[model samples]
Target chain A: MRGLFKKRRLLMVVTALSMLVLAACGNSNNNSNPSASPSESSAAPATETASASASESAPIEKITLKALMHSSWLKGGMEAVLKDAVEKTGITLEIEKLPEGTDGDNLIKTRFATNDKPDLLFFYPAVKESDGLGKPEEQFVPQDDQPWMANFNKDVWIDAFASSGTFYAAPYGGSSMAVMIYNKKVFESLNLQIPTTMEEFWALSEAVSKAGKVPVYLSAKDAWTLQIPSLQSGAAQDNLQEITDNAYTNKGTMSDFTAKRQGITFLKDVVDKGYVNKDFLSDTYDNAQKALANGDAAMYPMATWVMTDISTKFPDQVNDIGSFLIPFNDTGKNMAGIFPPSAMYVVKGSKQEAAQKFVNYFESIETQNIYFGSEGGIPTIKGITNTQLTSAELDAQKLADEGKAGPVGVSPSSGIPQYVAGDYPAYLQDVVAGAKTPEQVQEAEQKELVKNAKAKDDPNFK
Target chain B: MLKRQYYRYSMLAPGFCIFLVFFVWPAVSNFFYAFTNLDATFKYTRLVGFDNFISIFEDSGSSIAFKNTFIFTVVTTISKVGLGFLLANFVNIKLRSTNFLRSALFFPVILSPIAVALAFTAIFHPSRGFLNVLLQSVHLDFLMQHWLTNRHIIMYSISFVETWKWTGLTVILFLAALQTIPKELTEAAKIDGATSWEQKRHIIFPLILPVVNTNIIISLIGGLKVFDIVYALTGGGPGNASNVINTMVYKSFSQGRNGEATAASLLLFVFILVLVSITNKYLNKDNRG
Candidate 1:
């Protein structure tokens, strides 16, 4: 009786194994088919096109492209936008968002370490070669070979990846302008106009304060939030080009953020005057949205990304928020500062052809117009304008039209520290907390940036 | 008999292979990477030997992390064990409420550490958080201070949260050990003119020494390797103020400097080993005697 039962179990196991093998084969066929379709279907272009359209717009083979990115990118209308993007690209997307900051970086590193890379990665643009690695191409494939390079805004796009003359990623939307998003209702309720200069802005803040509302929602709990006024000041520099050029060469100093420049000092002004949110140090990104939606804070300095979050959380106030560049200049001139975006990269040794095709489609003006607003940044494609502009984006567009906006980086070219606050966010936090004076913060930043340059074995390092 | 023995040896094979695959292999690989400049990209790696270790020491952040780790381990171990021992004595009494009290005390031990830390984050929020609100409500507004952001007290605030969660386990362990001590031994000590403290010192305490050793070693190891609480709560920040060794390791790892991260981790491993060894030896000196 036992032997008979064992025989039946063995038969069942064989059947399951056969089905598993069949399922595995089916999955491979699905992923590999898209790579072949573009070329194969091209030969039969007219007939294939007709057949594809007739077949309810479904591609001959369905494929899932694995994409990894920061968790924050998933918010706003990003899902609806990505769904439309994936439909357009003829491939489905399987997205995994890593935690923000260090956790995300570590998780990506582990994926790289195991050689279990995603096919498509939405990540910060950086390349580290310590002058020790023999050859860079052993790990990465450059976009110089990718066909879509011809369409990008050449000057801006080429430097989006590593500054090493080896481009490896696709540039989509990058910040060419940052704006201070405000509640229009609060402005109207308090009877105030958006100020155009730093002095007027402060005066406006004072007016907002007297009206019994938070003038500025400073979510200082997030260390990255401390970089805004400093980055704005970077944009205002007449010597911004010289500063960024020399920063990688170990010649950059904290004096780059001089008091006369009005970025960091502007933050200090707000802090000193108590124009910053009372619970600024404890309030988070989400809390700021609630505050803004409810008219608790009249103004917040953030990129366009906050628009979707506010709109989603408070659908009623979607049109109530307006945006404008922070007036950091003494003359109160409105100017916009651009920061880099976390871009999408085609992973080497994956379905490269399919990934690149999807990327090519995704970067087109039509696709990017939608993607950029979801990211709360401007499109990197030269002529692509975000069509679904929030009141804030329209304000940014006005600045862009005047040619008053320019791309700014903490270190734009050398990639020493990709983000403006890369090495000095903590020091900025120290300054904000009264633990360190601005001079002290500057000295510490100078020391750390130099250290970072050397650590990366940057060519410009002294 | 020989066939039965062969089957027994075969049964051990699966478990041994699991240990080899999961624990030994990764540990050995990590130790190897400690000597190499293997980054996240894995595009380039060179054996840099002691350079990685030297760099860790040279970085000022690592030193801060090391100091934070030591303070966290020492403070949490002493507090958890000491408080657990006292609470164990209180709850081990023959009373109905004590039975309920034991359950309530042990309840936190079952809750996730990350969940606890996250809750405490809101509790410790500077303005709108529960702690400050409660303080304001009671008109002790002067006592309201930044719990997680104040640089001076950030580590202690984290340590207190950690202690609050794990101290329950220690209490249970101590209570079990206390229960194992005979009522007769305590009664005899009391009849011989020993006070409650005297009875505990001479009778209950000596018998519970092994359990104390166990709790100290467990908590010391936990304290040394603490990661989730700090990661979820402060994230070693507002500028690395509450950074411990594990958080530092995570920072380096995220930066794709595998060698530096592994070197930091190896140092942490050695620190934990040394702590465990010292406590184990100190407590078992009586057994050796």
Candidate 2:
């Protein structure tokens, strides 16, 4: 009886193993069928032009394109655009949001590296060789031939990814410029004018502190925010073009770019002067905005997106907020720092027809109006003219129109690796906490640049 | 008889295949990748040999990570073991609230580390946190700290949270082992005119030495492998001041320096193996009883 029972149990185990192997084979068969359908449907449209009406009468074949986006890109009229694009085009977007900061960068890079690519990727226009996405020309399907390219404002929106003018991504959002989003009520109450030089800016800060309010609120907890003041100062420098070009390669160091280091020094000086809030390290961007709106703080150095964010969230205090460039030097000619529009790149050989159709619909003037109208900012596309600008928005635009705004920080052509560029905020935090001096931060950055340059097999470092 | 023996060995087939595919394959691949210049670019791959390991040793950040990891491990292991033993003894006593206290003490161990870290993030907030508020209310204002911001104390703050979360498990393990000791041994010590402290020291303490050894090793291994709490809390920052080896490995991987990250992970693997083996051998030496 024991021997018979053992035989029966062995038979059952063998049967279970056979079933598991069969199930694994069945899964692979199912996955291949969907990938083939996109190409079949794409071919059907071209061949069946005469029978287009009949094809339309039949059920519309829906294609779902997976889109990977940073959590930060989820804001700024993204929901409306995503929903509207699906409705207009037959492509359904399966959106996956990655975490902000270095974690998100790792996820996207790994996905690209492992060939676990999504159909669409929401990213910056610039593609660094070291950021894991080797070269945009090879990794992405170019959109230069798309019909929307004719309408795209080429003069205003420079395709930094396309050095050869072979566009691989499309601009789908408004640009953001770094400015000091301050409380006009506090400024007016203190009878202070906007400072044009470093000395004047300090005098104003000192005045605000005496009035029992925080002079400059630094949201140091969010490491990204720490680099804004320095980047804005760097943008205002007359030799910015030279600095970025030389600093990125092994040709120049941070010590040579005095303007860039001035920003870090400015941050250190603010902490030393006790002009910032006591809880700068723990204070987040959201809390800082609230403090600024509630009149607890006088000024906040941030980008233009906060203008619309503050206006929408604090409707009552909308008129009381304003923006201006941060004066890092005593030169009296500081310029606003502008970041290019965030873009969407199509992965090579994946749902290209559906992805392109969705991109075309998204870049239309009507859709652009819908986006910029809700999320107030400077539109990168040509036809959106009636955006309702906030007071702070107008102030930043005024700076840009007066030829006082230029590209800031690391541009795509800056040749600085994205990972190395990303470390600037962390280094600034080290400086803020008094763990490292500005010179040490510069030295640390120089070491990182050389190490990454060698890794990229750059001849300059050799 | 041979055919029946073959049938019996076939039972091991399914489990062995799974182990080979999942665990062994990845571990072997990790070892292989550690030697090459693998990165996110994936364009060129070649064996750079010990260069990846050499780079890790040279980097200043890696040194800081090693130092921070050491401090975190020491602080967490000691606190978890020490506090867990104290709590276990308290609940082991016969009292009306014994069951309730035991349940409450073990509850935190079951909580998610991410959720626990997030809760502590708010508690450690410098200005508006519950901790600072409580301190201010009690007129202990001077005791208030920049918990997550101050570079010097950030690792300790993270270690404290880790200790708080895992101590309950340690307590339960110690409790189970403590109960195994015969009550007659303590009672006999008491009859011999030994005080409570003396009874605990001579009888109860010596008896629970095995459990103590086990708890220390378990806590030590846990502290060495910690990643989630540190990542969720500070992200190894205030300028990498609170970085552990795992977070540094993550940062390296994120920066597309895959080879260096893999090398660091292998180093971490060997470090754990050597340390745990030595500790296990030393602790078990007195276990003949």
Candidate 3:
């Protein structure tokens, strides 16, 4: 009986150990799949892209696009478009929704590095060196000669992804990068019109400040908030393209970035003069709209996305909110900054003919109409009218139509590896705090750029 | 002898298979991959030897991150373990509400770190936050601060949240250790005319010294390797102000510098290994003594 008991005990131990081993092996398999999902997202089954495609589209040609998209595109009602495309084209979608912010960027890069290439890349086409998603000759191509290019909004496309005479990706929609949205009621009370030049903007802000209200409400605590006015302020440079070109081509240096500091200086001046909200540093993106709604501030430097947020949050103020250009230059065509919309890219060796066919058909006015009905932002496809639009979106759309919407943010492929384009906002934050002048940030950026160039083996370092 | 050896090997096979597949295989592959000049797409990859490791020191931001990580680990470990020990002693006293107090203290540990960090976000909000609002109501407005934004206080604010979330676990650990001490020992200490402090110092402290050592080692390891709380709270910013080695590893990986990220993670692994080894050595020595 004792010997039998000992053997049974050994069997139990082996059984438990085998279970542990199996569990560990299962967890290792889960590592290949990302578990990034926003709160509202449904938990998807862990299905292999190929297997899923084969099973669903077995009766058809099994055209599955393994897609990677940023969370915003998913949350911003891009599903309407994706579902519509699948229904129209019969091409099944295998989607990977990435986490918000730089986490998604890392995941996409990791997927690429691991040779796990998705067929369709639906991401915001950022040209910043760090946001190396849709760089020239990387995973995607220009595909400029495609017939679908004719339908894309020409002005916004040129501003957003086009650099070095190579278009980066297809922009689904675009907006004036820095639309200075304001409470028209406050403007009316102060007898202020939309400022169209540098002098007018400053004077208007000063007048609003004298009226015992915050002239501007910068949600600086949300660091991404500062990029709005800063990027638009760079539009003051008449030769902005030349400077950007020189920077990437190794001919530009820190000296050329001097003009880009004007907005930062302007912001510092406002903050120092007590014209900005005292609680601006603590005011979150969530509360900024509420503040504007309750008349806590007059103007905020925001994008059409903010405009969308405001209308969504406070539906009563849809008509009350108005937007204008950043007006960094008195004479430079009110240079509008347009952000690249979340766009799709076809993998190089993907079933190109089928992919091209799907992409081409998705661009048709009928498909875009169904897409635009649910989606906001300026329509990328020509002739898709944006209904229930705010004055801000309308103004931005007008700029897009006029070919005045300029590019915004650090060029993604500016090749100067050291100086982070995103760090410009941090410098702006310090500038407002009166800790460092814009020149100091520029100096640090210069040193870093030189180091980066040397490190990258760029010939421009000397 | 051969059959007995075969039986022994068979008994070991399951756990070895797990460690071999899950741990050894990936670790070996990762170690090999660390040397490669792996591009964004892995298309044109080659071995680049120690270049990835060299760049670890080459970047200035790396030093700041390492320093912040070290400081955060030390400060939070001390705060959690010290506070946890004090709370454990107080709760161990003969009182009616000691059970309730113990449960209340351990509540935060049971809650998710992300949830705790989110709650701290509201608590630390400079103007409208609970901390500042409470301060203002109490006429202590000067005590209010930009908790997560100001680079100076960002790490402490994050560490405070870290300590708050995990201190309960340490308290519970210490409490369990304290319960093991015989009541007669304390009664004898009291009869000998030993003061409360003296009783605690000589009798209680020495009796729970092993548990104390264990708690310290646990706290140290937990503090050094913390990620979710810091990631959720400050994200190592206002501008890399509260950055740790892990956040830097994340950023490097994001930028498609996989080789550099692997090196950064390896550096963290080495730091953890050294600290844990020292802790183990101390604990083993104490047990023997």
Question: What is candidate 1's DockQ?
Answer: 0.35
For model 2, the docking class works out as: medium
Interface RMSD to the true structure, each candidate: 6.2, 2.6, 4.5
Order the candidate numbers by lDDT, best to worst. 2, 1, 3
Candidates' C-alpha lDDT? 0.71, 0.80, 0.70
- The fraction of reference interface contacts (C-alpha pairs within 8 A across chains A and B) present in each candidate is 0.43, 0.61, 0.31
- Among residues 3 or more apart in sequence or in different chains, the pairs in candidate 3 whose N, CA or C atoms overlap within 3 Å are A127-A411, A127-A412, A128-A412, A177-A337
DockQ for each numbered candidate? 0.35, 0.60, 0.30
Best prediction by lDDT? 2
Estimated TM-score per prediction?
0.83, 0.93, 0.83
RMSD of each: 5.9, 3.1, 5.9
Could you give candidate 3's per-residue lDDT for residues A332-379 as a string of tens digits? 656566676766666543344455555666666676676656645666
Write model 3 residue lDDT over B1-289, tens digit each, in one string.
7866776787778778878988999888667767764434432246767877777787666887888888888888899989999999999887999889988999998898889988998888887789999999999989989888787788888888888888898899889988999999989989999999999888888888887787788877787777788888866666567778888887666545666677777778788899889878977797667
TM-score of chain B of 3: 0.93
Task: Write model 1 residue lDDT over A181-225, tens digit each, in one string.
Answer: 889999998788877676788888999999889998887777676
Which has the greatest DockQ? 2
Q: Model 1 over residues B45-109: C-alpha lDDT tens digits?
A: 35776977887887777778888888898889999999999999889888979979998899888
Q: What is the lDDT of residue B127 in candidate 2?
A: 80
